[model samples]
Target chain A: MNFVEKKILEEGRVEGEDILKVDSFLNHQIDVEFLNEIGKRFKELFKDQKVDKILTVEASGIAIACICAQYFNVPVVFAKKMDSKNLDKETYESEVYSFTKAKHYTIKISKRYLGRGENVLFIDDFLANGRAALGIKNIVDQAGANLVGIGIVIEKGFQEGRAILDDLGINLHSLAIIEKMEKGKISFKSL
Target chain B: MNFVEKKILEEGRVEGEDILKVDSFLNHQIDVEFLNEIGKRFKELFKDQKVDKILTVEASGIAIACICAQYFNVPVVFAKKMDSKNLDKETYESEVYSFTKAKHYTIKISKRYLGRGENVLFIDDFLANGRAALGIKNIVDQAGANLVGIGIVIEKGFQEGRAILDDLGINLHSLAIIEKMEKGKISFKSL
Candidate 1:
C-alpha cells in the first residue's frame, strides 16, 4: 500500500454501511500537508503528460484539483453543478446524479476556460459510481479537449465505477483503492 | 493595484448589473499560477500573525484558502454551506444572507478542525456584502478561535461590507477594492 492508502486506512471512517467519510482530513477539514503530498504523487504519475488545466466538480473536488494543478503548473477549472445566469449563456454541461444528495444536477463549465486540444486532468475526493467522473468527461468531450488523466484521491474498487471509466479509454490514476469496508474494517488494494 | 487586482480588471466581466463575473480566472476557473501569487501576497500581508489555519466558505473559497495555507504551512478548513447528513452534528455554524441570490443559508465548519485559541485566517474571492466573511467570523467566534485577518481578493467598496466588518473591529485586508462599476468601466481603491 502507498502512503495515501495507509493514511486512508488509518484516518478514514466507514459510516453506517457504504459511506467512507474522510471528512476529518480529506474533505471537511483539509490537511494541506497531505494534499501537497497527493499533489506531488500526481505529478509523479502524470509527469509525461502535458496537463494545461485541471477540471473538477464544485465543493469537494476544488481543493484537490487546485493543489494538483500547482504541481502541473496549470490552471484548475471546477464544474459548477448548479444553473447560473452568468454561466447559462456559453457553457459545456453534463447531468450528474448524486446518491448522497438524492438529486440530479447539470454541472456547467464556461467555454472561456476550456478549449480545443487542451490537455485536461480531472481531480476529485472520491470515486464511487463514476457518475460525476463521466459527467465531467462529457463536458471535456463537448469542449473538444483531451482527457489526459483522472487523478482521484480515493476509489471504491468494489463498485462498477472503474469498469465504466476504463471502458471509456481514459487513463485512471487513483492514490488509494478501497477493496472493501466491512464491520469498520477497511481493506485496500495492494499496490 | 496588485497582480490579482490587475488580472481581475483585465478579464473580469461586469455581468448584468452588479455581479462581477471573474469566473474566467477566480472562482469557477482558477488560475493556479495567479493563485500562487495570491498565496505569496497573503503571506506577506499576514506575516506578523501566526496563522494556524485558513478558513473560507466552500465551492469558491476552497482553492484560495488551500493555496494560501501552503504559505502559512497550515491547513484549510472550508465551511459547507449545504446541509449534509454527515455534517449535521458537532459543527460550528453561522447564517449568511446573499444579496445576489436573495437567499439565506448556514455555513458549517467541523469542530474537529477548529479549536479554542487557534489563529484563523479567512480567505475568499469576493467581499461584496461581507455576509460570507461575517458568517465565517461567526464560526471562528463560536470555536473560540482568534480571527487573525480576513484576506479578500476583491472587495466591492461601494457596498456596506467593509463598514459593517469594520464595526466588528476585524482586521480586513483586500488586494483590490472596486470603487464602482459603471458602463463596464472599472475603478479600484487607491492603495
Candidate 2:
C-alpha cells in the first residue's frame, strides 16, 4: 500500500453504509505535513502536464488545492459555493448537485481570475459521484480554459464517479480508492 | 510599508465605502508563493507563542490557515460554516452574523480534533467587524483550548474588530491594516 492508503487504514473511520469519515486528517482537521506528502505524490503523478493554475470548489477543496499549487508553482482559484457581496459581478458559474448536502447549488469562478487557454488542474478531497468534477469542468469550459487533469485525495471506486469521468476522457489520479465498505470494514481496490 | 501593504495598494480595489477586494492575489485567486511569504511573516510575528493547532473559519480562511500551518509545523482545524452530514454530532459551535451575506450562521468544530488545553492560533484573510474571530474564540473557549493569538492578513482599521478583540485582551497581529479607504484609495495604519 502507498502512503495515503496506509494513512487511510490507520486513521479512517467508517460512519454508515456509504459514509467514510476521514475528517481527522483530510478535511476537517488538516495535517499539513501529510498534505505536503500528498502534494508531492500528485506532482510526481502529473509531472508531464502543464498546470497554469489549480482550480477547486470551496471549503474542503481549498486546503489541498493551495498545498498542491506549491508543487506546480501556480496560482489557485476556487469556486465559491454561495453568492457573496465581495464576488465580482462577472463570473463563470456551473450547477452542482451535492449528495452529501442533498441539494443543488451554483459554483462560481470570477472572470478576472481564469484566463482563456490557461491549463487548470482540478483538485478536491473526495470523488464520490463526480458531479462536482463535472461542475468544475463546465466552468473551465465556460472560461475557455483547458482542464488538464483532476487530482483526488480519495475515490469511492464502488460508485459511478470514476466511470463518468473515464467516459469523458478526464485524466484522473486518486491517491486511494476504496472498493468496498461493509459492516464498518473498508477495502481498497488493488490496482 | 510591508509586502502585504504594497500588494494591497497595487491590486486591491475599493468597492463603495467599505469593501476592499484583493481577489487578484489573496482570496479568489491565491498566489501560493505570496502565501508562503505571508506564512513566513506570520511565523516571525508569532514566534514566541506555542501553537499546537491553527484554527480558522472555513472557505477563505482554509487556504491561509493551511499555508500558515506549514510554517508552524502544526495541524489546521477549520470551523465549518454549514452543517454537513459527515460532521459529528458532538461539536463546539458558535453563532456568527455575516455582514456581507447579511445572515446568521453556525460554525462548528468536531470535539475529536480539539483537545483540552491545546494552544491554538487563529488565522484569517481579513478581519472586519471581528464577528468571525469572536465566534472562533467562543468555540476555542468551549473546548477549553487556549487561544494564544490571532494572525490577520489584512485588518480594516476603520472597523470595530480590533477594538472588540482588544477589549477581550486578545493578542492580535495584522500584516496590513487599512486605516482609510475612499475614492479608490487605501491608506494603511502607521503602526
In terms of DockQ, the best-performing candidate is 2
Candidate 2 per-residue lDDT over residues B1-191, each given as its tens digit: 98999999988889999989989898899988999999999999999999999998888899999999999999999999876889999999999999878899999999999989999999999999999999999999999999999999999999999999999999999999999998988999975
lDDT of each: 0.87, 0.93
Give residue B136's error in model 2 in angstroms: 1.2
RMSD of 1: 1.4
- Which residue runs does candidate 1 get wrong by more than 4 Å? none
Q: Give the TM-score between model 1's chain B and the true chain B.
A: 0.96
What CAPRI grade goes to candidate 2? high
Candidate 1's residue-wise lDDT over B47-125, tens digit each? 9998888898887889999988889998888899866777737888888998877888888887888999999999998
lDDT of 1 at A142: 95
Error of 1 at A44 (Å): 1.6
How many Å off is the CA of B163 in candidate 2? Answer: 0.9
Worst 10 residues of 1 chain B by lDDT: B81-90
> What's the DockQ for every one of the candidates?
0.78, 0.91
